[model samples]
Target: MTAIKPVIEGTDITSVEVGNTTLKLKQTVSLDSLQELISAVENFSKFFDLTSLGSADEGIKTEWNEQDLTQFLSKETREDQIVALKVLSDKGEVTREEFLNEMKKLLKNPGFRGWDLGGLLAGLSIRSRTWGYESPYIKEERREGNEWDTFYRIKERYAPLIKKWLKERGP
Candidate 1:
């Protein structure tokens, strides 16, 4: 078996080689990027509806539900956000304001600094393009644009951090 290895070439560069293929990424990673990367990998299974891709009984639907929405939104509380910041920080020493600023960048919501639960729900709803008073859920829109590309790039750059976070979070 060929062992794949990933290397951090610099503060803003990472490279991974597998068999005959190599991938490289360059990005200034932040705590918010790390957190977003972790969340993306952790929730990857919920991004697709496998049941709809094949025989209805052959595969399970992995779409996010109301419970998932509730759990996600619950993490927006001040205390929970603080915990998230601690988890994402290098030494658990980041301030609440800085954490909130990073979160705003991660979520691409400029108004997130002042966001409460209602604002968060509203922002998520708008981003998901649900357009109405409804629970936030992932939609079936194809990922595009520089934002999505940057997300994947950051994910690649911070795969190790994401793995560590996932391990700490447990199964």
Candidate 2:
């Protein structure tokens, strides 16, 4: 039979060993001692003032560190915008002005960082011709004679790469 290990608290015999069994001797513990033991068990089971037992501090710490996503807001990327546009377009058929208004409102949110622009555009451009806001500065960039063609070409190239990245990142 395996050797049993008894538990001692100072001079008090908390538990006794008989063959391979450990029998608890002090059934009525002091309030402080009971609270401590309960807290220790709640903190880490198998803790009976035994030096051989391990602590669960790391596991508890990790479990506590996970983010609470209920408070988090989803960010924007072209991909996300595109996807949003697609879904919104399918369900309600919003006008360009309405869509831009919604996008503007979404952009103002603290959590709405521009991350999924490609997906956003994929979802957005089908029913719309403009971004959320009209800018005199941006108009020059989209002009035919301007170097904005380079920017447009770059985005055209960006689609496939973005699609691949989003696929790897998952829905």
Candidate 3:
């Protein structure tokens, strides 16, 4: 059997080899910046399937109804909510204003015992910054203000190293 190498391994900083150049990534920084995006994309596929079920079969129309919406709201974490919102926004089902309005309505409903609306809203606002959405409630200041900023900074810092590695591998 051949030996298998780990992609990332370290205590504080992780060493990852893209092609030939090995780059050091701060474990906390990479996880903090990219974990949500990674999770959102992963869960998005499932969320799409769930939403598509309604369109796939007439019997499944009820699956996307108020109760289902309530359940989704109640169960989804902050990252999931962001993914859901992004999916909805992409589908043109709701704009940012409509999403916020719906959230407000949900917040006022006593029956909707769900995740904290404030945290969800904050997460949404922060995620929107990278896509150029302006929110009155959330302001992303500098490099450290938003997760996207952190992701960008990390990518920028590592691009040279990655490029060098890539060059070592010809087409």
Indicate the residue-level lDDT of 167 in model 2: 48
Pick the lDDT winner. 1
Please identify model 1 stretches exceeding 4 Å from their true place.
1-91, 117-171
Residue range 123-167, candidate 3, lDDT tens digits: 644443433332212222122222112110112332343233324
Q: What would the TM-scores of all predictions be?
A: 0.21, 0.19, 0.18
After superposition on all CA atoms, what RMSD does each candidate show versus the true structure?
18.2, 24.2, 20.1
- TM-score of candidate 1 against the unseen true structure: 0.21
- 1-78 in candidate 1: lDDT tens per residue? 333444333332143343443333343344435445434433643674322332212232333344443344344334
Candidate 2 deviant stretches above 4 angstroms = 1-83, 86-91, 109-171
What tens-digit string does per-residue lDDT give for candidate 2 at 49-163? 3334332221222111112111111232354454443334333434333444455565664444334433344343322223222110010112123112212121232334434
**Model 1: how far residue 87 lies from native, Å:** 5.9
Number of the candidate with higher lDDT, 1 or 3: 1
- Candidate 3: the clashing residue pairs are none
lDDT scores in order: 0.37, 0.35, 0.35
